[model samples]
Target: MNPATRSAFPGFAWSLSRQKTLAECPRRYAYEYYFSHNGWLADASEETKRIYRLKKLTSLEMFFGSSLHNVIQNAISNYSKSRKIPRPDDLVRLVRSSLNAAYIDSTRHYGLWFDKPSRYTMFRDVYYGDGLPPDKIEEIRSRIGACAESFPKSKTFREISGGRNVRLMELERFRTLPFADVDVVVVMDIVYRDRDTGRWVVADWKTGKESAEDRTQLALYAMYLQKLYDIPSIRDITIRNEYLATGTWREYKLEPIDVDNTLYVLERSVMEMRRYMEDIDGNVPYELEAFPLTEYTRHCERCNFKELCGR
Candidate 1:
């Protein structure tokens, strides 16, 4: 493929979430990172284009999470410069409006997405679910309200906007640090110094319930931040997950051993992913059969590539 054909994709990059996807469903992962490559081209195979369309589907929860995170990301970013914090009510209103727009788009934008999959949104709800139920819609709105209310009022957010010496604040930008001969990508929600505590903070916002893997993900991020920015001590970094939907926060202080374990895990994860690779140097993957599909109906039921998998 020409460079222009691959402009939208990063070619191949390792990430904690991408690793999780590989673990969750290798077939889906292959479709995502490999077969769908160059699927966006005008002269691409029909099957490849269809695969790319399915790949573009974002579930309702993911859609909402991204929407809210982006809004809050911009708010914090603007506050870092303007020192004017956004109102909780305004954020809530914006989220509700966006939700409405997305719901309509999911229902009505099929033709547009068919013409240009990358330009328009393709929601998994409409594709897989045929759109969510009324109760589900209300539940999403309720969660959005809670998260929006919690953010501008949360202790961590308050301090960030409460006029402190914020430095090295990274938000909504993809950053990479070379590891094990691969580019490890991380899109950190926010990373900055507390200034008062003389500690570096990696704050990750959560829209849904907590996961056991969250600690590991945070640890990976913390390690990446430390090495990328050349922070002196590993213990000086603080990992936090702000559970916005519930208005709760938790912090994990990284010890030297934590960073060591994270690196070990990262190395193992990278090795596991390479098992399906046909060419490690070129970042090429093997045949579809090499990546087995999961037998679990629960996972496939809501998956975007269900049709392709014949789930």
Candidate 2:
């Protein structure tokens, strides 16, 4: 597209989260992918603008995870220079301050966020449902505290902090994988070379409980490493999921079948996504009706657009 058209329409990009949203609810996906496009423009309809605001709503869990990720990135940079990992207590303080700031954004800065949704933060619970309960807030705090305490002491951390052999690639950075059809956007948390094992380590920090989805994420990261660094073998790379909250970690050396499976799943996801597009090459979605809502209302309960959806 030319500059004017580019400003008006968003280009297509495939992501794991985008695919997940499409699977979870087609209507929600429409609100997110199509309805919210170019919403920052002054000429956009009020509903379009509102949907854009809804798109920015961060849940408490999301906020916590983002904060932890930020700390990890900063800590990695610092360790690379100072040769010392950040103290766990310091990580706790950093998380607390960030949490406090997000709370203020949700509670006291609605007017600012309303005026500029992309600039300020608005949390889902505060907008769509009751504010976070005290116990829930306490649980978040405990989780943050645990993760902060655990991260600096993890076995993975010891290696990353070890020395010159440790080459950390793309800490919290967005790397594009030009997949077969569309550009696949991936922001992997941590990718590094193990100081001791001398193998590529693709790692992610988790502030929440483990799920099957975590493996899917690791698989994506592994593929990313394979392409980015020209990693020779799937078995050559060790993928690690560090559950900071539990002070535990899991490592997997993927087999050839794993890479094959990841390719199959990603190709299928892209194909399914394109099915909703009217002009595949032009990146135009079909009319909103083409994408139906999920049969399950349970997914809507916590969605920021629930109010707009009238679910």
Candidate 3:
């Protein structure tokens, strides 16, 4: 391992996903961010190679989430330009085509090994096997289609589409906020500002079940926005999560204390991660043993590194 690359302390960047990975399994975090940092090097260790392979793995649910997010983002972009929402059939076609191309790439180019069948293939296999049923596929399709159809009609969509009063802030772009200790990266699905009320809204698109983590994620976004724009208070920002699967919306008006608590939690988490990286002697590279596998065996079953961990 290049000590220069690996020993870059205090320059650590934090994201919600990265923090969650560390919290879920520190071993996985070390593999992802430390050991596999430069896995492409020809002289990479065997452990690095193994971790790199595990890092490249993706799940059917991830593919579906990405494709759905793309469809929605593209639809909004198109409507922003043309002021016309694509038909439900067109959206479905777009989703299926995107998934089909991803499936081909995953199987052929990446050589991703699936225990069963790819999600796209599973749609047809439902007739012959105990895989995902046809109705479930249709349900998913309908959910995405409904999200597309309803998005253009929502008040937030209208405000953003108008592009006059509530201007979209760096549509579908990831922005970073540098803190004293660590840099925080936030990729907001949609962020807009109401010119009249001088209020900013940071919106996230969710295709999965809501979790408490969602609140923390949004709180961080709101806090970041406050710092990024030099806003006087958290009350000036509203964080929203749009659940595409059910077309339900949840909004949070963060209080000053919320942002304070979020910052405390974030700093504490980063310090803990930093402690994991500290190596007093050169013998224990990455302190891999310190980061143990999760005690929850159920998480191991779905982990991409399951085989590597010999679970």
- Which candidate achieves the best TM-score against the true structure? 2
In candidate 2, which residue ranges exceed 4 Å CA deviation?
1-3, 170-172, 195-197
Overall local distance difference test of candidate 3: 0.70
Q: How many residue pairs clash in each candidate?
A: 0, 0, 0
lDDT of 2: 0.84
lDDT of 1 by residue, 210-266 (tens): 998889888878878778778898888888899998999999898899878877988
Per-model TM-score, in order, reads: 0.93, 0.94, 0.81
Superposed on all Cα atoms, the candidates' RMSDs to the truth, in angstroms, are 2.3, 1.9, 5.1
lDDT of 2 by residue, 96-210 (tens): 8988988898899999989888878878888765898788899998998899889988878877765547777754488677867668888787777865666888888888999
Candidate 1 clash figure, as a count:
0
Better of 2 and 3 by TM-score: 2
Ranking by TM-score: 2, 1, 3
Query: Per-residue lDDT for 1 in model 2?
Result: 31
Instruction: List where candidate 1 sits over 4 angstroms from the true fold.
Output: 1-10, 168-172
In order, candidate lDDTs are 0.81, 0.84, 0.70
Cα shift from native, residue 194, model 3 (Å): 1.5
